[model samples]
Target: MIRPDSFVPSARLAPSADALLFIFQEGRLLLREDGTLPQGHVEDFSVDLVNPLGMLDGRPVFGARLVGEVPTGFMLRPLRGVYGTLSEDLFGLAGYAMQIVEWDRTHRFCGACATPTVRSERETSKVCPNCGLTAYPRVAPVVMVLVTRGEGRDRELLLARGPHFAPGMYSALAGFVEPSETLEHACHREVREEVGVEITGLRYRFSQPWPFPHSLMIAFTAEYAGGDLALQPEEIEDAGWYRVGSLPTLPPPFSIARRLIETVAQGE
Candidate 1:
């Protein structure tokens, strides 16, 4: 199993030189050559530099942009790529840039006094003109649970699939923790909301920084309490208990949800 701890980015040595190039098509990412970031070191007229994500094949690959059509750009690239490939790191950088661009696009007007906001020179931040409120890259925290039950032969973990997921996909129960709620509370709420099942005995398992537009995934293990499995109509399409010794297909290794489930199932 590919663990999240092993995933890497290459551009770490030259922090001061990388740039975030915006391939603007009336303001949307161009998608052709879907994975080649312009060879900045060899090319002149490089737009802007981004933080070095990491190196690819000993050649440093920085986050970059290319000229392309606007209308099709948004629909062309999927936010999360399913399998591993060289494009994976590039995709991460692209997604990170997209998040910054999206934040800037959406926060043009200040919320406090309704005045226009401006991009800050301080890097990856914005400032409101009227109230001086500063906004930085936002990262939301979410919790995922591997809820299990049964003393011996009956031990199982709860898995669920959402309507938005691809076919035959099953993943750990997850949800963003709401304001004023504890991590344990978030775990319980997500289970109830997604699978209509109750869970107890929550224990922290691990965490990963999932930078698909900034989310921190917190993984946990818990015990199943009494409740029937009922798919939440609006969110989930199916759910069930799978014996611990055997499992269904899981999310890719980059996801903490997959790591957490695997760790528990392996009796680690």
Candidate 2:
């Protein structure tokens, strides 16, 4: 998990000799040939907007979207493609940058009154000058639960694959938290709705900031309480209990879902 206080977040920035920039174009990040963030002043590139992303390693960092041609030796790749190539801190910053760009782009106008919104000078938010409405970079919280049964080397884990998952890949069950619901409720409801089962001893695990479009995955472990495999066709393509060595292709290690699985099913 990325530390939330890794750096002192600032609402302003001024590119200089030591500044680092995380620039994106159409949600794709710009990484250099050696897989690193661009550093120093970015005067050569035409940027649509630049937002401060706090201070890192005593260097000012900024996030922006490119309007100019891609710089030579710098490839525009999806953030997912740069997962293992960049440092954990850099990946976190990239996720932050992606979310900021999306928030700024989509919230140019007020949702309630349709008035143009202005970036807050005091913090990371946008304000509608007319209605006092404010918008911040928001993260939708999702719960990922890995259900387990039995114990030790013979321990079995309940895993499933979504319709959109890669071939033969399976991961923990997950769903978004709905309004007026607790995280625990969301977790149990998701498991029951998707697999027609109940889980107990819901143990809280770590979380990961997944930025496909700004979601915080809260992972957990639970004991199988009851019910049989009755997969919800619309949500789950397949689901079943499997031993560690027989597990299918799981989610990438960087994801919280993967961590939850590895925490219990450590072998193989």
Candidate 3:
């Protein structure tokens, strides 16, 4: 249960440290002539960069979609890549930077006071000019759970596939934690709303820092309470209790949801 903040800082060279930085007009990161440096030397640049986002070896790469004029001969691709692949550290920092910059760019106009917000410059934050309000990187909290019964039980953890997802793909129940509600409360509420089930014996599992525009996923394990299983319309396209012996297609391995499910299945 090592928390992200628990990691002690060391004399580490961060990816963005003395590294070239670029913001694509199309939201992608621009690559240098050698595809090594993101753009130019950390400071001065010359030629115009292309829109970020394009595929390399068929893998989705982002940093595309510039905010201003689009560059010619620029490619477009997805923003995810396998860990340890080409410049993992660089991509990681780039992703975080992209999310922050994008959020700042879109939220420049303060929703609270409708005032123009200026960049903080001190760190990752924005401040409103008129209201004098400061806004930081927003990380939405989401709770995902692994529901289990005793060992050798004929029961299966609940799984569901949204209509928008690929066919036969199932994922754990999840929902955003509302203001004034605890993390456990959000877990129970999501399970109840999505599968018409009650959960008890709550316990913390693990967590992952998902930077899909910032989401802190808190994992938990809960016992299922007896209830009529019913799927909420629109929210869930299909759902059922698939026995652990023959579980359905699960989420990708990179997801904490899949890890939670796997841990429980192993009788942990």
lDDT scores of the candidates, listed in order? 0.64, 0.86, 0.63
Candidate with maximal TM-score: 2
Ranking of candidates on TM-score, top first? 2, 3, 1
Candidate no. 3 TM-score? 0.75
lDDT of 1 at 193: 80
Provide the lDDT at 166 for model 2.
93
Give me the candidate number with maximum lDDT.
2
Q: lDDT for model 2, on a 0 to 1 scale? A: 0.86
User: Model 3, residue 131: what's the lDDT?
Assistant: 86
Instruction: Please list the residue runs of candidate 1 whose C-alpha ends up more than 4 Å from where it truly belongs after superposition.
Output: 1-34, 41-79, 87-95, 151-154, 211-213
- Judge candidate 1 against the unseen true structure and give its global Cα lDDT, from 0 to 1: 0.64
The TM-score of predicted model 1 comes to: 0.72
Poorest 10 consecutive residues by lDDT, candidate 2: 1-10
Off by over 4 Å in 2: 1-5
lDDT over C-alpha atoms for residue 98 of model 3: 60
